[model samples]
Target: MAVYQLDDELWFPDPHLGEEDGLVAVGGDLSVNRLLLAYSNGFFPWFSFRHWKEPHWYCPLDRYVIFPKEIHISHSMRQLMRQNKYIVTFNQCFEGVIRGCSSVDDRNQEYGAWLGSDMIKAYTELHRLGYAASVEVWEPQDMSSGKRSAKLVGGLYGVAVRNAFFGESMFSLVPNASKLALIYLAKTLDGMGGLFIDCQFETPHLKSMGGKHISYDKYMGILNGEKDVELG
Candidate 1:
């Protein structure tokens, strides 16, 4: 399959026509409208930020997702939850979460770093407009005044469209911090009748937490309010 080159026009080629690697197009600006359109149609921008001059959009045919109701809570995670060692909040500090995600492991200096300055700026604008959201995990810290304050430790951020969450990136300052955030997100979404979380790709971490593969057609059906499709 040929990789399409996007122009100044506000449109995308058919997602099904993407290359086997899932790259559909390249050279588009990450404007709010463009980003929203891409996500609404099951596409997302992910490329080596330092190497690529513009956004590279992808839409994989084999969709890996996590249904909120099916999110796995392992025995260890359950024990940690019972301990109540971390505090979780939604949209409390999106900037902190995004920055943490970008800087962890000095990703900016590494090749194939998708989260860069430009992407950060774009997503920050998305958060300002209520299109994006964050999940923050904090650890309690005692100040000199004997007052307790929470320090940002770990979290995740993503785009929310209707009933679906398009996960962007996540970071963990401590072991299982990111996992805790994901569990909380799943519970909250489950309560609100959320459909699924688009994991974008499969990872052992996500797979252990109940992420599963589904066809793009099924994914689109769920996104389009057709909830009767069977999940794999």
Candidate 2:
């Protein structure tokens, strides 16, 4: 299947026409309007810093997502949560979370990539406009002060459109920090009634947290069935 080449126009090809590797289109700027349109249509950009010639957009045949209410918390994670091992806050440090995610070193892993400077700049702008958001995990600074100050340890960032959340990346400086961030996000979304978290691609970690692979058609049904939702 030939990948569609996007021109100067702000448009994307039908996601169902994507190649086996999920490549739907190539060559497009990461403007806020473009990104928002892509997410609403169940498409997302995924390219490496080494291949910066043109941006590649994809919509996988097997879409992975997690219903907020269905998020699985392991016994260990529950214990840590009960102990208040980490404090989770939303939209606190958008840049810090993304920078942490981009800096994470997974050299020994098969699937590892960094968010290049261009991606960072684009997403930061999105956050400024309120489409993108972040969740921070922190540890207490000093108990002796009797005042609450936090030391950032881990977090995750994503773009929320309507009733869906597209998770971009997450990182942890200490064990279970990122997990806590995810748990908090899930619980909060669950409280908002029906919401979904787009995992994008399959990973063992995500699968363990109850992420499931669904057909693209089914995924679109959920995306299209919703009205524009406020992220706050």
Candidate 3:
């Protein structure tokens, strides 16, 4: 399959035309409108920020997603939740969460790091416009004044289009912090009638947390309100 080159026009090729590896196009500005349109159609930009001058868009035919009701909570996570060692909040710290995802563990130093200054700026704008959100996990820290303040430890951020959430990136500062964020997000979405979380690709961790593969057509069906996702 030929890789399409994008220009100033706001458009994308048929997602089915994407290459086997899921890469469909390799040039486009990450304007808010472009990002919205891309995600609404199951396309997302992911490229090495330092290595590429333009965005690389991908839409995998095999979509990996997690229905809100199917998010798995392991025994360890359950125990941790009972302990109440951390605090979770939604959209309370968008910049902190994205910066943590971008820079945690020296991710920005890695060669294929996708979250950089431009992506951060763009997504921050998206958050301001209410199309993006963040789930923050904070650890309480005791201050010298005999008060306790929360420090940002871990969280995840993603874009939401109606009932579907397109996950972008997540970071963990302590063990199971990101998992807690995800579990919290899943439960919160479930309460609000969210259908699915578009994981974009499969990972063992995500699989363990109830992510599953469905055809792109089926994924789009739920996204477009044309069909309901079957929950197990």
Candidate 4:
């Protein structure tokens, strides 16, 4: 046993420092090295500075995951899919998507924008390095009129690691934009083998995509199996 244990406490200092599950440490600095290492080991920092004495690390016993092929599209969504009214593209506007996702002005979900300025800089840097990616949904306008045409509707941004994808966040300017993006993402990622999507926590939106919990060991294996991200 380690000298200090954060048992029953839902935070850990580093991935290696994590307990069997739930939490691992506290008060550790949130440096890039530590964050990256934590992710690589299936641990993530999810603390409330307002509530907790210090930052906490968590690696839940059951991880939420969605298989690409397992994505669920409703009949109404199918109609929208057939329309193809919106053009969906990858990595076209990553920062925009991140900002959209960072918005906390939605019902049911509380208004808490924790992505922070630091997060933007950090992920944007990853985007520059080609390790992170974004998907954009644009409403196409009639080109015959020669207008700039349409506005950005929705998008999702995440990090790709090997055959796995670590979903950061997503948002929609209009309803269903994010959902459409997820459908496209699932279809696109299906071609790759060993593809597993990590949705840090559970929600109704993710449940529709067949998100379920897995043993931490299983989650680690999937993350470890990924060697490099496939950019399209």
Candidate 5:
């Protein structure tokens, strides 16, 4: 249980230890310099401060992601896209997107998000520093009958790690906010030579977008490729 890491990069714990081993070290300030190094080297903060002693770093065994070429927009969703009922914007409502994501009502038996106040604050700080980003899809302003609700509803927040954009979390207030955002991100990745979305976990919704599972070893290769890409 060694602790007291750094504000920048450090060796990750061996996956064999699992989440319980809590090994090696933790506790690093999330500076843009630090976060960039972490993502470049296949590490990311879980956005925690439970123990002031260390910042936990994890390299899960499985990575979830989707290839832009394989995106699946259902016929109904395609129709909706055609309607252009909602508009997508980048980095407009960062805190709102994060709050929406952090507070999404988990109707599908999904409960208890690990994105706590500390995590929110940490990532929010990242947004302030411009190291992190959020993509927002706004509900049509006129759509609100009483107009509280609109077609604009979902978006996500993620970190750009070199060519690999590590997805942190996302929420959908409207019907397809998350999916629409992912679609745009996929297009961006295709242009950036992005290899994968380091989705730490799996979800059926992501799978519907063609998210595939790959070993962490392979994921590391994508990050450490010979052609180094400069991310925006």
Candidate 6:
């Protein structure tokens, strides 16, 4: 399929026309309305400033996602939860969590970051408008005055539609910290009657945590079916 080039005006191509690698369109501004529109149609922007050279949009033929009911919690993660080793909170530090996700040293890749300043500004605005949200996992710090405080260790941020969470990125400072945050996010969303957590694309790490790939048609069916779920 041909890649559509978007103007400063707000619009997107039909998500079903995406290519194999999921490059559906390019060159659109990251306005909050545009972001919301894209996510509502099962599309998302994912580009590296260095590698891709442009802000590319994608809606893969197959999507990676975790249904709330299918969330997997390992024995070790359960132990962590049982021990209360981490504290999880929502929207407590959205900016900090995004910055941490952008700045963390990713041992997997040697170069660029997808969460550029433009992306950050756009999503920060989304949070301000209550469309985007964040989850933070913190570890306690010993205070000199004998009071206990928690410092940020791991977290994640995503966009929330009516009944679906479009996960953008996540970061971890301690082992399994991000995982703990994920567990909390999934379970909480489940408890609240959310549909699924869209992972966008696939990765081995996400797969290990129970993310599964489904055809875009099926995904859109689920999205539309859950659009009126009234998760709030």
Candidate 1 — number of clashing residue pairs? 0
lDDT of 5 by residue, 119-151 (tens): 677778878877678888887665446756434
Q: Residue 133 error for model 1, in Å?
A: 0.5
TM-score of each: 0.95, 0.91, 0.95, 0.79, 0.76, 0.92
Enumerate residue pairs that collide in model 1.
none
lDDT of 4 at 93: 84
In model 2, which runs have C-alpha deviations exceeding 4 angstroms?
A: 107-113, 145-147, 226-232
Per-residue lDDT of model 1, residues 52-130, tens digit only: 8788899999999999999999999999999999999999999999999988775556646778888899999999999
lDDT of 2 by residue, 1-232 (tens): 6789998889998877879988899998899999999998888887576644768898888899888988999999989999986788999899999999888888213333537788899999999999998999998888787887888999999999977889998999999888889889999989986468999988998989989988887787777773443211
Off by more than 4 A, model 6: 107-111, 226-232
Error of 4 at 43 (Å): 2.4
lDDT score at residue 207, model 6, on the 0-100 scale: 84
Cα lDDT for residue 177, candidate 1:
94
Q: What is the lDDT ranking, best to worst?
A: 1, 3, 6, 2, 4, 5
Badly placed stretches (over 4 Å) of model 4 are 1-23, 26-32, 47-56, 106-111, 141-145, 226-232
Model 6 lowest lDDT segment of ten: 223-232
Candidate 6 local distance difference test against the native: 0.86
- Displacement of residue 179 (Cα, Å) in model 6 is 0.6
lDDT of each: 0.91, 0.85, 0.90, 0.71, 0.68, 0.86
> lDDT per residue, candidate 4, 1-232, as tens digits?
1314444333344344446656656556455555565666666655443355544667666788887878889998999989888899999888888877766466214423456565677678767777678889999776897777777789898777556777878888888998999888888888766377778788999998678777666677666663453211
**Candidate 4 lDDT score at position 183:** 84
Query: What is the lDDT, from 0 to 100, of the residue 186 in candidate 1?
Result: 92
